[model samples]
Target: MSNLLKILLIEDDAIEVMKLNRAITSLELKHQIIEANNGEEALEILKKKEILPDIILLDLNMPKINGIEFLGILKEDDTLKYIPTIILTTSNNQKDLLSCYKIGVAGYVLKPLKYEEYVSKIESLLSYWSINELIKV
Candidate 1:
């Protein structure tokens, strides 16, 4: 692998995960996608890794730990702080949007309910990251 295409997906929904995986594969990104059901699980994955991901596609709602709280903790840690986190969630609340930005999320992408829209959004995100040269594996 080129180390330029590693993505960590912190999502609780299995179906959404599958859709995302298919989208990334279709893009021919040469990427590795890692899944975490919640913030806590995601943190453990980060701890076990020597190098952080190029990007994180995070969901807001989860069972054990919510995305807002997770972002709070992630932004505080020096080692994990630099990894860019993009909120890929279903929330459209002004408060949630404001709060996420306040915590320093790189981008906020609303979840697309429709299949085609979902694929489009994911591709755009991957393209943006690739163009920016942000992937560090």
Candidate 2:
């Protein structure tokens, strides 16, 4: 895997987007975050085949084409399925967790209420991925 990573962030909430941005910035990692408000927009981006993200940060709740639906479509595609997708959701529901894992998500992480805890999670996640080997397209 490359040292610099391109991350696709699929989230509907603006405040959550801001928090993620803040967390990434605070980490001081050499990474690029591409944002999409919903799953449909993210699919469009993926279809373009311009710049494929190494990892995806997905949210379960969205306006249209929620994360579970998106994951189904993504995992069906041979090329896209290789990208590691992690669920960064506020939902602590057991059903949601089971659904995500069953759909083959890389990780399911609950969103922490505190900024410090959130940052810590992001930092650890990024650090781990940075060292790991990723499939090259």
Candidate 3:
């Protein structure tokens, strides 16, 4: 059976955030998404540990602690390291992609220019994860 996902989206851009929400709403998916404007804010949210997210969608660029650096810190933690983190960024830089993989990111997806394409990608990504067995702890 497919599970309802609790998603954490760590993104700095307001438009990007809106677009993700739009996609989810238009697609009629019932997954819950929690927003964090940057890596720092995301860390704060995670530190509470009251309710851990099923998966994390991270952005490469931000004000403080970019995605790669944030990933490093998260991997060092015993509990946080297990949550699936997908790089959801506009960066198509080879180095960034390689770095994310080296640091153990679950997936790396580039944000498409077209809204329709972006929606399609989001749907597929969410669909796969919702049905996949995710580590709750």
lDDT of each model, Cα atoms only?
0.86, 0.93, 0.96
lDDT of 2 at 117: 96
For candidate 1, the 10 contiguous residues with the lowest summed lDDT are: 128-137
Top candidate by lDDT = 3
**Which regions of candidate 2 deviate over 4 angstroms?**
none
Per-model TM values vs. the true structure: 0.91, 0.96, 0.98
Please write out the lDDT profile of model 3 over residues 1-137, one tens digit for every residue: 77889999999999999999999999998889999999999999999999889999999999889999999999999999999999999999999999999999999999999999999999999999998998888
Rank order (by lDDT, best first): 3, 2, 1
Q: Which has the better lDDT: candidate 1, or candidate 2?
A: 2
Q: Model 2 — TM-score against the truth?
A: 0.96
Let me know the TM-score candidate 3 reaches against the reference structure: 0.98
What is the C-alpha lDDT profile of model 1 across 5-101, one tens digit per residue?
Answer: 5788999999889989888777776777888888999999998878568889899988888999999999888878888999998999989999999
Give the C-alpha miss distance for residue 79 in model 2, angstroms. Answer: 0.2
lDDT for model 3, please: 0.96
Pairs that collide in candidate 3 are none
**RMSD in Å for all candidates:** 2.3, 1.3, 0.6
Assess the local accuracy of residue 65 in candidate 3 as a C-alpha lDDT between 0 and 100. Answer: 91
- Screening candidate 1 with a backbone cut-off below 3 angstroms (N, C-alpha, C), the clashing residue pairs are none
Q: Model 2: which ten-residue window has the lowest total lDDT?
A: 128-137
Q: Please give the distance, in angstroms, between residue 116's alpha carbon in candidate 2 and its true position after superposition.
A: 0.3
